[model samples]
Target chain A: MIMDDYKFLFKVVLVGNAGVGKTCLVRRFTQGLFPPGQGATIGVDFMIKTVDVGSEKVKLQIWDTAGQERFRSITQSYYRSAHALILVYDISCQPTFDCLPDWLREIEEYASSKVLRVLVGNKIDREDREIPTVVGEEFAERHNMYFLETSAKESDNVERLFMQIAEDLMKQARSRDLPRYDSNTTTIDGKTSTISDFSCCSK
Target chain B: MHFEIMDYELPTNFDVVVVGTGIIESIISAAASRIGKTVLHVDSNNFYGGLSSSFNLESFLKLNIEKRKSICMEHSSLNDTETFFPINNSDFTLDEVTHQWNITNKNKNYSDEENSAQEDIIAKEICAKKWLKDDLLKESRKFNIDLTPKVQYARGDFIELLISSNIARYSEYRSITRVLTWFNNTLEVVPCSRSDIFANNKISIIEKRILMKFFTSLDDNEDLIIKDYASKTYKCFLTDKKLSKNLIHYILYAISNSTDSTLCLEGIGNTKKFLKSLGRFGKTPFLYSMFGSGDLPQEFCRLSAVFGSVFALDQPIHGLILEENSFKSILIGKQKIKAKNFVLGLNLTPDFFLNKVKKKFISRGVFITNKSIMDSDNEPLTLLLYPAENDKNPCTVLELPWLSSCCPKDTYLVHISCNQINNPEDDLKHCVKNLFTLNEDFKAFKPLIFYSSYFSIPTNSDENVNLHDFNNLFICPGPDSELDFVTAVSKAKELFLKMYPDDEFLPRAPDPEEIKWDGDEEPSDIAQ
Candidate 1:
């Protein structure tokens, strides 16, 4: 809970086809504050959540986007700077489940290299889940994505998702600090961005 | 092998038969079984995985590791100083192999030189041009798509509209899908106005107006520019303004490239339909898969199995058997099973199904792997690699963190789809060979072959061809031209009605007689 430790900012973008709950999930996570009822997210909304992962105190900047087909040109820009992405699909809906690859592809394009993405099947609480859990895990596993089934309404695994992202980022930072690779890192775009400056621990 | 689960002799005849052993077929059979009816599931191939399955685990894992390493490079570069982003050691470290597990010293020099050449070629051929006015005009006529040429400091253009406009109010995933739809011609993009939206003070006045003017005129009509600049293909358009090459490439990569732009407008359309069909969402509008894409489907199967849904393997339905007013049972390996109801989750022809549907619709290309290629203690999850063609190739590639279920260490799988638009046999061969030459990481791993095929739905109907008129039959052909998505899903629904009773509702599926299979001559009334 220390303010200094909370300085570490990790931006996470939620992306998928239209009506995949990209917005609802974000609002559920950010505004719901871990377990509550909320409506759809408008256009683009950013929320800050402070979470303690073991000893590391991480501040998560969550960007909830609109999944409509007409808005790709407008919302695509936000994808570039994200440190991680949560690709969500409705389990009750097969097409949404089918479209997960495309959503993951966007994360690959716009997000930073260090982006840690988790494939999430939202709405697992429903009785007639159209998409089976096995298929979903296979999709994520095939693409090397960390996979999980979660219900934003149930607030199931909501906390675990963020904690995992924070852990991933911390591990990435440490790995970059390893001996063989140079201390100074330059981005693929040639800009000299530094993650070490924003480095903060959970404690 | 466990013999405790004895095989009950399956029925010899079925009312309807479905082909393909992929996820879609599994769902169809499971759904049929859940409704208290007997169903037969079959695959033409000896094994499963028609675009969705991981037959060869080694390549899958290798691809993932390479993807992770690429992401690691991106992470390190994003954090590094100018010029150096530590390339080695992260997430899963290289014990003896590079991030891609390229252990052979012979390939290292070739890989390095090849990568550099590819980069240069990509930059020169793909990145040499700025967005011209005419370049923004052309798009897929069928899909109603369009794009704006990227010009440097061209403020107020599509990019500005994207950043400034508050589109989230319209829908949960409006902006991203909107942009992608526009590019893919799946949805019509009503260019949101960008004039007042770009009035940021941080940007200088000139830059601001450039951005502003560009944004405001995006919706205006323009000419198409298909030109070759520095040997790279340039599809530019005019919007009453001009921009730089760098800006244009960024826009294209962000919207059209492979990695980030995998799903286009068509995908959005199907997804939108699915969400709407679910009715309303309350406090719990959104749901996520517990274990990944594979887990959710598996859960559905688990639930369906509990409900007595049977999934038959090694059974591929080649053709349907009709008997008078009702459809007879399907033939699977000289065995026939009879059912009170039947639902087909297959294409009209197996080969056509494989070429058009399996290769084009269901499959995706990716780099996957297991066990970190990087030498490190606590492995990083994702990696971004620069493919030789990253600059010029419209498709973007990345290595994601390894998934244990798909590939346990030292094992991996990657899916390669032949261009359905090409000649079938040639396309498949080229697809396999090109996969190896396309990326350096794939070169190290030997590809153990696997096969799966799917077909597209039919269009243009003929008389006397009712696939669902029979008492004991129904078919759910994935996505097709003749029938709508609602009709396809409800084909199963109507079949379910045979078992459950509510006031008999209208048939939701397209009339079977209306379905038109390609290459088949129209059945005349006399024939009927």
Candidate 2:
């Protein structure tokens, strides 16, 4: 069996108020294009982007909210197993930024305690921005989360946001700070072995 | 900051409105949304799964307290042409709930020499820590205690549907490492695979050869042999084959996973299913979803959301309006949402719709134990089927280790379920006593229960319920007393077909890499 060539795989989930450019940030970072009038995301589950962290390649599986955030119905399973959570808000929208505490409450409730949280204030290119950069920075500082400002329309800071997350997670993996990936192993008689060696009806 | 209330009104129209987030309703929602039908999936409970949700220890206890409060049914006036049926959101399915912590809050003290010995053992092996009740309560969120726990056969209908529909990507699973059986007052591992049969030391060589021959014979059509035993019981067929009593016990209780009175054809079918699913993932034929079985339904809901289905949890439906025997719309608070079709869970269905349908109860017990029932060097995900003894029915036991993400480290989540003869504790007390130690000092080797909960879930066993009054309304049954979810998947398919006979059921959803974003001139390729 051929395995994907990556030293580490991290699941980074995106959550915030709806229409806050969460999808746009993901599309800009993974697809390298800003989809204007990106209607409710359909047929898209998650995006995978492999990047080089130092000498090793790290794969980032980026999952979108799929419009579930609109109704606050995101399943708790969505937060399970996530290595990082990127909480996005629209800079020009006050409600989206004001709802950050609600989003943080959800994160504190559902996400793993060790999960890395990053606060991204999106739509920096909009002229009538309600939230200043300092305000966002102070909020992120209060929450002890990594802070950044990104304009998905102009494709500014989007790449840097994801790269920084990948580098940090890659460093954690190298240092054994994160949980070891044990999805493919089955233990028998105290011995851990990969399941690829076994097949049904081999007899 | 200004306290502003965001607009909470949902769209008033939909192609399909599903009333529950159970496995069947979620599957139907995904199927309908997969084919471009606008869907609105709602659950009165804040959690995703209605009766199938998994809860942490804190919420599980809180839910029991809340379920005890009784609410009178509210009457609503209806027009002359319309009849109103109020929706019952109370957890009527779960009854006789009880949980207790056996261990105290204080940690066990050790002498200096004993402390050094404990440290050596911890350093040498990943053994379970002597957890006090305070530690368990503090880390209660790590536990994913399921209300209706289930396992999946590697080649079963649910697995096939998951792979076929591409919903498998959203979830993770751990293969059940061992299948055990309690026989002759002893717990033993059931040899399920070819390697296991050859490696067995308990059975004689002749018994092993006979078991192997019996299994090999199932591969052949054997139409004549099947016909000869079609009218007889499986035990009678095994006796006629001249197998030893030990082999018969293993075949009937462990492999076939049936009672003594199981028909020959049904028993053979079950055995073949077991044989067919072996080695697909591991030695055992079963795979349990990581976290809990409640995560399974949420995975389908995620697929549905990806396909443009609107979901709103904690949204209660006030009542359902039926106009001249046909389903019309539902009342949510002060809002009326209309849909062309409606699918409701059995608990949400009115009494008139479920008249004459006999309800069967499945007694369930969830226990957090200090060790595995059958100790091994490594923590193993175990499935044990204790055969019926005397008046007790056959019980299914699933012991999930922490690696399966069902419980915290150093503890195992043990679930025992059987047909309800009385209350949950009474129905499963015999099996629980045989497997675990309720008191700390009784059985030295047996696992000690720290926390345990017992409850009974109501399910409709009779299939012939008269549902012909409303063409667009469908009622999905709750989880049955089955080891696997083959029945739930089939029920979902049946309901989907009844609603949309021409629409295709959930087809293969495109992977994230396959979805081409607009404005990209080049084909989007994944960076794997």
B198-293 per-residue lDDT for model 1 (tens digits): 433334466555644543333233222112122222223311135443223322332222223333333223222222212111111111111122
Go through the candidates in order and give each one's DockQ. Answer: 0.03, 0.36
Tally clashes: model 1: 150
Q: How much is the lDDT of residue B338 in candidate 2?
A: 88
- Write candidate 2's Cα lDDT for B1-528 as tens digits: 222224488888999999999999999999999999999998777788877889887888776666523234344445678777776555445757898889888755543464577565553353347778888888878788888899998878998888888888777789999999889999989998777888999988888888888887765656975779878988998898899887888889998897899998888888888888887777788989888999989999999999999999877577688887677888776668889998888887766665664568889999999889997988899999999999999999999998888788889999999988888888898998988886654226688888888988886742635676679888888878778889999989988999999978899998776775555344443221
DockQ of 2: 0.36
CAPRI docking class of candidate 1: incorrect
- Candidate 2, B-chain TM: 0.92
Model 2 per-residue lDDT at B389 = 93
Error of 2 at B432 (Å): 1.6
The native-contact fractions of the candidates, in order shown, are: 0.00, 0.33
Q: How much does each candidate deviate at the interface, measured as C-alpha RMSD after superposition? A: 25.3, 6.6
Give the TM-score comparing model 2 with the true structure, all chains together: 0.92
lDDT of 2 at B472: 88
> Candidate 1: lDDT of B501?
53
Off by over 4 Å in 2: A1-5, A36-40, A185-203, B1-7, B68-80, B108-128, B356-358, B462-464, B519-528
